[model samples]
Target: MTIHEIDKLTGQFYECICFKPEHYPKYDQLQELFYGDGKLINGNYDQPLEFTVQSYIQAIMHQIDDGNATFYSQQEISDVTEVFGKTAQRISVYEYSFTAENTAPWKRGVNYIQFILVSGEWKIVSMLWNDEKEELAIPEAYLV
Candidate 1:
């Protein structure tokens, strides 16, 4: 994707996570890329991934139980940086994370995430992370 296109798509993704109240309206679109073609699953190897996706969504919603959902809105967006080159299609992987002040202590951990250009827009396609441990370390560059 052109830098401009990537920027626009990246902004949309962040906005959806941060400020959009109509979060579920785009659920199908979001899931299509992340879970499409059974990509989130592994008929040959890993366990079914539907549970993972459901659990992930549930964890975020748990923040809403105590009125903490707005932290997503207050999240600091990383600069719109990209590694652009030609491989197959207009694909770029972005890394971003949000640290919630006053988050449930049990929920603290860094997320390694990636998004992809599905048809003409970027969507989160996969994410993996380590468990929350004592002394969770934020990267030096990410400290604001």
Candidate 2:
């Protein structure tokens, strides 16, 4: 597939799954777009727990519910690169702005998502992300 089509699909990735929490029920469908069980690695573990799709979904929902958070997200797909012919990746600098009824705003982050061309369609294979912190900011190249 052309990189342009893949780019649009990447936008859909952010729109369908990341930005809209109401669509969380259909998250498994999103997961289905991935190759394996897949993972969303948020750097909270000492040994990098590979979160299966189900685990990630459950954790995300639980966090929102337990924290009483109203979650919102928007991503700017800053760059896309083809790893190999059928393997591609994109780095998105996103505004994951959310707020809890009793807490401060949620931190923004950058995500690196890899997609594999399975059958005829592109599917996400792995996703890794990290929140921008005071000590460690997003790199300049990732910016628009």
Candidate 3:
């Protein structure tokens, strides 16, 4: 049951960020999945960019408003999750596209997500992710 709930929460995490041109992104829903003071980190560059939950939402909104990400969708291709007591973690392999109907993703990446059981509910406490670059390809094992 714990794993199931975690999976559902992760699914919701992805759902909140995806949107088509005609639809608004569900970025606000992210507040429900994150704990107080939850953070997200983007480690794709030389220096990691860290954000509080609200800041993360604002950043994505800015991207959309700037027309940089007018249409976007992201989904998990694979994940490995481990649970111990009230704390759990997941290494999720994901694929994303900027096009509305792309059969293949334009990019792939990995996310390290940390969770804690709070009041019998699983909530994301932190997440760090890095996109796959030309020199830093995702390993075959992670893809499977």
lDDT of each: 0.42, 0.68, 0.91
lDDT score of residue 121 within candidate 2? 81
Superior candidate under TM-score, 2 versus 3: 3
Arranged by TM-score, best first:
3, 2, 1
| CA displacement after TM-score superposition, residue 36 of candidate 1 (Å) | 2.4
- The TM-score of predicted model 2 comes to 0.76
Model 2 Cα lDDT, one tens digit per residue, 22-93: 544346466666688876787644666668787877876776677554455555636746657888887877
lDDT of 1 by residue, 62-116 (tens): 7755556544442223432444442112222223334434454323333344555
Better by TM-score, candidate 3 or 1 = 3
Ranking by lDDT: 3, 2, 1
The stretch of ten residues in a row with the least summed lDDT in candidate 1 is 86-95
Which of 1 and 2 is ahead in lDDT?
2
